[model samples]
Target chain A: MFDSKQFEKDAAEIMARYDQKKAATLPLLHLVQEKIGYIPPEGEQWVSEKVGVAIVHIREVVSFYTMFRTKAIGKHHIQVCTNLPCVLRGAEQVMAYLKERLGIDAGQTTPDGKFTLSSVECLCACEIAPMCQVNDRYIGPLDRAAVDKLLQDCV
Target chain B: MASEMVLSKRLKNPGGAWFDAYVADGGYAAAKKVLTAMTPAQVIDEINKANLRGLGGAGFPTGKKWSFIPKDSPKPKYLVVNADEGEPGTFKDRYLLERDPHALIEGMLIAAYSIGCHKAYVYIRGEYIEPYRRFVRAIEEARKKGWIGEAVQGKWDWEVTVHRGAGAYICGEETALLSSLEGGKGFPRLKPPFPAISGLFASPTIVNNVETLCCVPPIIRNGAEWFAKIGTPKQGGTRLFSLSGHVEKPGLYEAPVSVTLRQLIEQQGGGVRGGKKLKAVVPGGISAKILTAAEIDVAMDFDSLTAAGTMAGSAGVIVMDESTCMVKALLTAAKFFAHESCGQCSPCREGPGRLYKIIQRVAAGQGRRQDLDVLLAVAGNMEGKTICVFADAAAWPIQSYIRKFRSEFEHHVETGTCELGHAYAHH
Candidate 1:
């Protein structure tokens, strides 16, 4: 039901490390997502068969790590830190500003496919509170002004 | 020419927001050294030669772990900084995040190049708002200067993103960290496909401790031989050991691996607070075996600590003075483990709760002597039976405490009260 070429290769590699193939589910999820930019729905069964685990086990692993994106993302994925530290440090206002600035809420993709904005839990750089991550780079400690400057740079 | 170990690179700035100050003090210069001069292989070779280990509890070899990433892989690779500093008695990562944010950025860049990764993530703890803000500004500074992002200074295209973790201690695990970075619940996964080949966004990934990754540029710039010569034969370079609790100087200190615990306490931490007699020390965070004053002479390296039946986990030296009770100390540590259990495995979930209840019973003056055996037996069975070492972490202290301080536990039960033989107030 899916293209198993990349998933098969990754599953084989990750599973080889373990005595049980079933244990490869988590690693496979990570590998598949990295290879394809995101995990397609059909990649689940491909992984389960390769790792010898049930499809349900694969789902549990996928559902567990939020990084395993079910759908495709824009070229740039903007995840704003909305957890307590960031929230306390005005991460909420940053999200609102981004929403107004981008004309999209936290979890929506812009029509241009350049940015997908989402309010994520925390970015762990609490000392640099009110931060947002664009793809693999961080842009932050924003009030309305700094976030706007970041958005301008992104666009 | 001779060099010496000076314990704790943390106070290098000594306090306040000084990004420019860190740069002026030969900080990012090391990173620029690697970025502008060395090739990826040279960096990796130097790290491998130094024999540095991750300070974040797990003690994995830093260079070897990075080398495990498949260089010729057909996928986009990543380097993630595991800055989720949730381990109790551990406040060192926070200082690095706040004080030397640029150092981490430099280290991340070096690590990213060595592992053939242009993309990197700094996975930090959720509660570190102030630290996160500081890092965000620092990262912006680096990016604007073109030290990071899309072929800076005629180098390769690079990306360093900051990813935050929610308020869950379990995310400190590498696998759980990757999960949290991907925007999922902070639950740890069974390892083996280890973060090396399979990590962050799934590509060939290298998940390194913040402190561990921070050591890379220096090793790369100074050469492996220079780096290796700083510490003991096997353990190399300086470490930022967070010294808190009853210490007079109670702050982060940087010394090489050969620095003895006594020197660290006396010279760095300024000895126990208010001249309080040193009773016991939780050498490395809450999980390590507690050491009494006699053992204070031991050095603070990975091997020496292991020989002493504990680890220098995250180098957070938590000192306990005479007034602290053993039961209370063990309980404080146990309560953290119990509360932080991710509810994934039963041995850790039920086991920690049971251990907590058993210890609580003994503390509340409702103990039988056999309860000590019960605690040991339960803790013994729980070890090595979970998806993560959290089980072993939860069990190790109980087993060690009961073995070393069995008298105190027995005394509490016999007297039907705290063994310190004093009236206890609910903390």
Candidate 2:
């Protein structure tokens, strides 16, 4: 089911950026995950072949970085920052609100598979404290009203 | 009071990153001047005269770091920009990367020319999607304008590649960054075969901070004397302090290094939020020792803070008012260190986890009397043992918080609850 022929074209471009082909391991894995939504065993083997590292080594790389996922997440992944700054600005309340509304704790996906909630460290957006990253965008200074709107907007 | 805005001058007016607008503001002039008129040694000397230190927490001298690269090393040299800015209370690099990325490119060109590095790599954090896009766009514009790529300004040859870090705070360390750049885990390698000697595939490498490089263009345009005059004698130019937490106005403010912490909290941050009395302040990032309200009169420079028994780390002044709880704050910080430790050394790998567990017990109203002593003893052992300074950084919050606010921890342990009211409930 995996598209090896199509993936190679993009994989070659990423490998071309680095002097050593092994340096493209992360980027190639990222590309595979971006297209497939998670790093499956096949995707890992493909990346291992492309970057010239063993599949076990590629799995080690995948497990080390927190961003790469082994399993697929929900349609919308929400990562709430519980670092000191956000905690000072009431990130706990935001997390609690999401938990109550969605009926799931941190690192859990919704039954409908519409949302995934995670509690993460600093995203380096402290100026907008009490913030969360939904997919790619950062929504911050979160309050009760904002949470209501965010859940609605997830659709 | 507004000091000389050296790094943030262009950020004042919006849309400053447009290629034509950046060119109109005399951008890339420094790169042109360095490539055409100045020798590599001259460029290094000029930076030395400027007295600029790295803005990414360590405060190491920039020119001295660049000078470490061997000119006669047959292997190609590399210039790696550390844009993996993930200090808990810091977010200034995101602004520079998004608002005026041309400054960083120009800085890189001059830096590459000075060190004879034909290739440069920028390691940006993956969470910073917007900042990364804006920076990549700026690089594309420069490539079209002949500021980057095979022939920079049609004089020297330089190429820049932007590498995105997956998600690890440890990658902010230079050695760890090189490891991640080489497509491995972000474990920091032992130094002495320092990056300047053997780095990025066994070649000489120079790793500079995002803000440190951004300061280079101004130092090149105006003479080193002019740049050095903007701040204290030891540290040149202004710093974009990332002011956040319990402040009425939590935002980035550019001020001279000579500026005291009080001025940043009062004048720039509009004092503590809701006119509450100031309590304790983390003068730098979470790792720096916390400063009480009385101790904030000291200058916010590297040396001054060092004399005051703290560090001017990352220039992230996190203001805390009287309402803030010290025990809760320490727990949050400890949690960060525990979560981000790369598990390389035995001390750093084990120490932060233990600290967080003990603190968690205290915060949840089940702490024993010997918890404080155990915490201090554990923290003391963690320092000076790790390959990197991460364990020491982790130990600081545990040491400083309990030392400065000993009574608070004692009250929590003895009474099994916070005396200052629940931190999360009211918030």
Candidate 3:
């Protein structure tokens, strides 16, 4: 389901950055995910072929990292930092607010498929505690007002 | 004594991340000096004299680590900057990356030169998008200015690439980082084939933390003795302590290694939040043993914290107040370790999850009297029995929390409900 020529070209460039082809597995998976939105079974096979490693090996990498999404996600993926630092700074309340407002528990997507809320470990942004990463952007010390604003923008 | 801000000197500059601003503040001068004038051995000697330690977590002596790279190796020597700042409560590397990207780049240049490396990589955490972009731009600026890449400043050829890590806390481990760099699951390799002996494409490699490398340029410029005199006798230079949780002022503070936990918490952190009494403190990262409020008078250096039966690991310094429940706190820590175990080794894979499950049960107000001893025994088994210290790190919080707050745990068991209410009640 992916563009083979484009994938091969990008994979070549990434592989060239490393001494060994095996080292490009994570980057290749990321590239595929960026392009395809999620890592398909076919995409994993393609990365395996490109990196010259076994498909199972690529699958191992894909499944190991929390960032790699195997299934399709919502338009906006809200990753709340629920680790210790954020927890201490009222992340539990922030998480509760999101769950109640969104009407979905952690790791669940909205029925409209507009939002997927997941509680993540430290995003290493404890400076702004009780934070959440909405897609590529980090929104923090999240209150009802901030989360409401975020939902408004997403909608 | 007031905590001196050394590494964070240029952090407040409006245009700090820009190449021109860094140059104006004498950024690349040390890299240039090391490349043109100083011998590789001389650079190593200066760093050794400075006594800088890895600021990532371990606090291994920096110059001594560089000295381990085999001089006669036929393979290309690589200097890997561990910018994957994943340790909970630690955010100093993020500051260094975002505010002073040039400093880290310059530090990398000097480190690469000392170890005779032509190529280096900064493996930054995937979540740090802004820091990654800043670093990438800084590298481009350095290249254009003739500071790095292809016979830099007409002295030596050095190149740096910023590699982004997929989300995995285990990648913070040096060997696991190399494995991740090689595009594998972030599983740590066996040591003795340590990074120095056989690392990254089977070459002799030197992996240094981002903050540790940032200390290099200043040491080179001012000489090792000046850097040495910054802190204590053995531990030299200022460290970035990421003070968060229960603190009035929760942010990154650059203080000397001699700075006590009390100084960091009271003086820099503005004491506990809402004028509450301090309950406990994770002196370092989540991995370090929790120090009770009274025990926080100890210095935050590596040896002192170790002497206090904890570590100055990653210098995270997560503060907890009296309102916090020990059971819930330990549960949070246990959950983090459980989620990030890598599952490569049996003990680490199984131990963390079991600890989390047991802690979860106890936190939920369902605990056997025997559960406490069971938790301790499981944690003890996990320690010193894995491919990497991740198992040991996971075991630490379990052992320390139980030992320090046995009464709190007993309360959970007896009352059939948590006194602090269910923090993880939603989960």
Candidate 4:
């Protein structure tokens, strides 16, 4: 199901940007994760060979960064920022609201596998406090109206 | 006000101006002038005279940092832009990157030419998807116009690469950023071999913050003296202060370094929300020591803030009103440091978690009088003992919050409840 040939072409292009091949490990891991929804063991091995780094080092990078997830999340991943700034502006209440609305806790996915909620740290969108990243988009200053709209759209 | 705005002037345009619109506004004129007329030494001299310091919290002089790069280095030099805006209360770089991205590119052009750097990398955080896309688009536009590629302006070969960081706050550190850039864990390296000397691929590398780089073009365009005269004698130019939390109008405000915390909060921020009485303010990002309401008269610069017992870290002004609970506030801050600690150094790795647990117990109304002393002792032990200053930063909130708000913390421990809430209910 996965297209290896096209991946090799794209991986090579990414590797060419840096002088050393190891620098491309993050980009390559990102590409693989985007394609497969998660970095499988094979994905790690592929990046290891492509970037010429050992598997252990690849695992280190994957584990170190909070964004890199080994398992697949739900169809929609909702990351609520609970850092100080966001917390200052009632992020705890917002998280509670989302949890109640979705019938799930902070680190859990819905029964239908449609939504995954995560409590994250400062996304640097403190200007729009009480914000979250729904997939790749930033939705924030989340009031009752915004949460309702988000729920309607998610369904 | 229009003329005074340097970095944020172009942010008035909603999605930012395209390359054509940016060029129309005399965007690349400084870079062109630097490449055609001025020598690298002259450019560096101008920056040195301007006194522009790093806006990414360190307050290091930009020109001094550039001058550190060895001119005779056999290996190729690099210019890595620290767009990793991870500080809790700081969001100024996000605006600079998303809006007026060309400013950063043009600034990078001048910087790379001044440092004889042919390659540049912008390490943006993984969370800033929109800003990252907007920045990459700006880079492509510049490259397509031959402003950032091989033989830029028909002068020298250069290229700019955009690298996205996976979420790690420690990666905001220069050496940790270097390690992350090299595709390793975001653990910081020892300092003797600074990045300027033995950096990226063991070559001379200069890592400048996004806002710091965005200040470069203006410094070259206007003479150094004009830029220098705008702010304090030691640190020149305006800063993008991120005013957040309980402010009435929470947004980015460009102010001279001489601007006071009182002016920024009362005047620019439209005073605190709902006309509430101000209780405290984090004059910098979360890391800086907290300032009481009485201390709001101090200026919002590196030197002035340090004199006031706080650093103007990233120029993020977080205002808090009287209704807030200090114990709960410290708990939130402690939780952040605990979660974000990279676990490399023992003090930073272990210290923050302990602070969070202790604060959590105090907030839960199950704390002893001895808990306060233990918190102070643990925080004291964490400071100045780690490989990086993260331990110091984590310790600051514990030390400052307890020291400043001792009575409130004592009330929480003795009565197992917040006095602020009790006072409010009674009133």
Kept native contacts, fraction for each prediction: 0.03, 0.69, 0.76, 0.77
Pairs clashing within candidate 4: none
* Tens digit per residue, CA lDDT, model 4, B1-427: 5577777778878655579888888899999999889999999999999999999999999999999999888999999999999988999999888888999999998999999999999999998889999989988899899898777777967898899999999999999999999999999889969889998888899999999999899888888998898899999989999989998888899989999999999989999999999999998899999999999999887999999998999898888999889888888888889988899989888889998888888888889889999999999999999878888999998999999999999999999988777221100
Two-chain DockQ for each candidate model: 0.04, 0.66, 0.79, 0.61
Off by over 4 Å in 1: A1-155, B1-10, B14-19, B421-427
Model 2 CA lDDT for position A75? 96
- Alpha carbon deviation, residue A120, candidate 4 (Å): 0.6
lDDT of 4 by residue, A76-117 (tens): 999998877887787888888888899999899998999999
Q: Candidate 1, residues B1-427: lDDT per residue as tens digits?
A: 1254322344454563356666665666766677788887777778879878887877778888887988778988888788888665566787778777777888887788777887777777755667888898989888887778887657778877665554577888888877656544567887777777777666788888878877775676567787788878888877777765677766666777788999988888888878989877778876787788889899898889999999888676777777766776676566657667878888887999888787777777888878989989999999999998888988888887778777877888788877455443222
Task: List model 1 lDDT by residue over A1-155, tens digit each.
Answer: 35666456645654554434454455566566667778887788777777666777667667654566788888878888654334434555677777888888777899988889976644444434567777667666678889778878876
Candidate 2 residue-wise lDDT, B1-427, digit = tens: 3447787778877688778888899988898999888999999999999999999989999999999999788999999999999888999999999999999999999999999999999999988989999999999999888888776656788888888999999999999999999999999999989999999998999999999999999899988998899878899988899998999999899999999999999999999999999999998898999999999899998999999999999999888889888989998899989999999999899999999999988988889999999999999999999888889999998999999999999999999989888743311
User: Each model: TM-score of chain B?
Assistant: 0.94, 0.98, 0.98, 0.98
Between candidates 1 and 4, name the one with more favorable TM-score: 4
TM-score of each: 0.72, 0.98, 0.98, 0.98
lDDT of 1 at B114: 75
lDDT of 1 at A49: 74
Show where candidate 4 strays beyond 4 Å.
Answer: A1-3, B422-427
In the range A1-155, model 3's lDDT, one tens digit per residue, is 56767667877877787777787788788888888889999999998988889999888889899999899998899999999999988898888999999999999999999999998999988978989999888888788898899999998
Per-residue error (Å), model 2, residue B4 = 0.9
Model 2, residue B287: distance off in Å is: 0.9
Count clashes in each candidate, considering only residues at least 3 apart in sequence or on different chains: 39, 0, 1, 0
